[model samples]
Target: MTGWRIRDYHADDVDGILRLWEQMLAVNADPVYGLSDVLASCAKDHAVVAVVGDEVVGAAIGRAAHAQGWVVFLATAAHVNGTSIGSSMLAALESRMAAVGISKLSALMPAAAQARVGAFLQQGFALKQDLHYFERHIPVQREELKILAELGGRVLPRGLWDGVGGMNAEKDLLERRVVMPLAQSELADRFGVVPPRAIVLFGPPGTGKTTFAKAIASRLEWSFVEVFPSRLASHPGGLAGALRESFTRISELEHAVVFIDEVEEIASHRQGEPPSPTQGVTNELLKIIPAFREQPGRLLVCATNFIRALDAAFLRHGRFDYVIPIGLPDEQARWAIWERYIPDAAVDIDVRLLVEMTEGFSPADIEYAARKASQSALENAVSSGAEDPEGPFIEDYVAAISATRATVSAEVAKEFREDIETVGRL
Candidate 1:
């Protein structure tokens, strides 16, 4: 029991299961077992097994075909009961099914295996009131499926957008200005609305501007590929040429939401005497935007903490479709952020009090305070060796909140307000 672990099924497990089944037979335990069936199940579907001391003790098999999934096999040695190995194997199988977009899973088992159904039930698998399993086997080319994975340059999980707790106005604006057009291109075109190609996200540092850019890509289900000026400066033809070459590669993808955070590194104002080193790169980026816009399924989202520092031409109407501001979270947004990071076990905690105390805090600042409180709570629990550890108390949160510093200083907030009044397009 000390060394037992549940893991993916290996090819050698076939013989091990056969041996286990033989041993069970001597004890008058009978199971509908066959070598060919087990072999085929392992080869064609998601299969996992429990192993203890160099022997396979249990197995669970599942297959996901499009949106429908099936649990075809489940077995565990009688000797391993109460070890929790059966439940773990079922969980692994369910996880694999969900990963591939399978929404529903059903199982059909022999009467002899009915005792093992408890494991599946414990893990949230429900008994279908009236259902039957049927199949129509079809040969598929596995290589063709690889093309789906290859199309996206850097596919981001859709869950990231959901985790971005606060900043509702910014999220709603991006959804309207960017996601709507791309997600409903056909409908947008019918309404004589052109899908947006480029937009600039401007705000003070640590305001979740970069997070919003990635969230937009996640919301659209498009690949996210960020272009870093620091890395591009090391390329052969210098930053300008590197910028050109990077977009050329990006253009190959069918759907992409490209990001350029801290874009001011290259797109800053071209000044005086001899001209800045960034001037040439800024020019190259200007030239790339029109060509990038010509492509139907692409969006170029640039983020800059210093909106005022960007070259005048770079943010002009023809160049960027919109210039949006992602300022500090409003009161409602702050409440959402607090709810997200606050631990559930902190029962009867005054969320409204926490929210009120967190005024003038950026999303990053609020997150920091929440984390610090959590860390303090964890440290207290560890030191006390308490079995049921308490969560961050109100006083603990106030202390953490007092210690944390806001990323957006007063001067920066004032500057951002000026930019919103003067430069913001939305």
Candidate 2:
């Protein structure tokens, strides 16, 4: 017998799953789902398929709402019908649903389908003859998301923002300017408040501008669509057309937070004798921004390390709602970053001393020093053959701090301060 394995469904499995669904219906089972419905369910919901080599031998599809879960489709190949495939597939689907906080799982099938109903019974599903299954279908917007995915856009997990350690001011600004307006759209509209459509996050390198943009998406519970200039450069219409098409598809989503990092690559100032090559792309972006702003339920976040390099018109009043700066971490932020990097141990390490010593370090710089300290401690422990090695000592951290270089130089920091004073719009 060929070895079989269960795994998450992929786009490639669509054909196999369709064939499997056809085979099940051929056996006089109820035919309620269309091909598009099945494909959409597989795309946006939790689905698993059992495969022997590349051939799908069994499958289960599920979705969760509130505290209830529904197994929309389940099937096994005729060759493997009597084997444990059916029960195993159900178990896998239930496990996935349970992970997402679904406590009740129910299935619907016609009374004549004994074999299909038996599979559910074997997997602990009770027969509810007293109850009836009724569903009012909602139109699936998954097709729009499918197009977005093909354009390299994705819906990121909400947990990402929680991982951002510090920069409380940046976080607060994002919440008030972006998250609050969108999340409380009805409330804000009632008070005659208009939600911002575009914002710019400007700062020195390694200050977590991109991180804040992603966190805003997470906080708003919206889909994230990052337009990659390099990826779009290969399109037939070139970079400018690719960007326009990407935004066109992105507008299909009900709610989205679009991001363009290192935006100065295309939006830089057009001054100089020969004129810049990116001037056309800059003009295209400016045109796209106004149209994007006219639409509700979307926000554009652009991040740049050198805000001064951008074209002056790009940062003008109507183009962006806010131009916020994300500077180097303060003492409290540094302490948070330090404490996060240190592992839990029986012995306490002096993190305040480490924080004080690395006053000029960015979050990334501090993380590097912490990793270096842990690495050196581990190497020493292994070399010395210490059985009960204690945690990284303060001295270990001190040595790492002395050796580690800060990413932000004093000169660059001074320049950043000047830029904030002169050009900052927050």
Best by TM-score: 1
All candidates: TM-score? 0.71, 0.69
Question: Ten residues in a row with the worst lDDT in model 1?
Answer: 132-141
**TM-score: model 2 vs. ground truth:** 0.69
Would you list the clashing residue pairs of candidate 1? none
Each prediction's total of clashing residue pairs, residues at least 3 apart in sequence or on different chains, is: 0, 0
- Model 1, runs deviating above 4 Å: 1-41, 44-153, 385-387
What C-alpha lDDT, on a 0 to 100 scale, does residue 90 get in candidate 2? Answer: 78
- What is the C-alpha lDDT profile of model 1 across 253-288, one tens digit per residue? 667788998999988898876776678888889899
Candidate 1's TM-score: 0.71
| lDDT value, candidate 1, whole model | 0.77
Over 4-71, each residue of candidate 2 has an lDDT whose tens digit, in order, gives 88999998998899888788878887745566766788999899999999999888888888767787
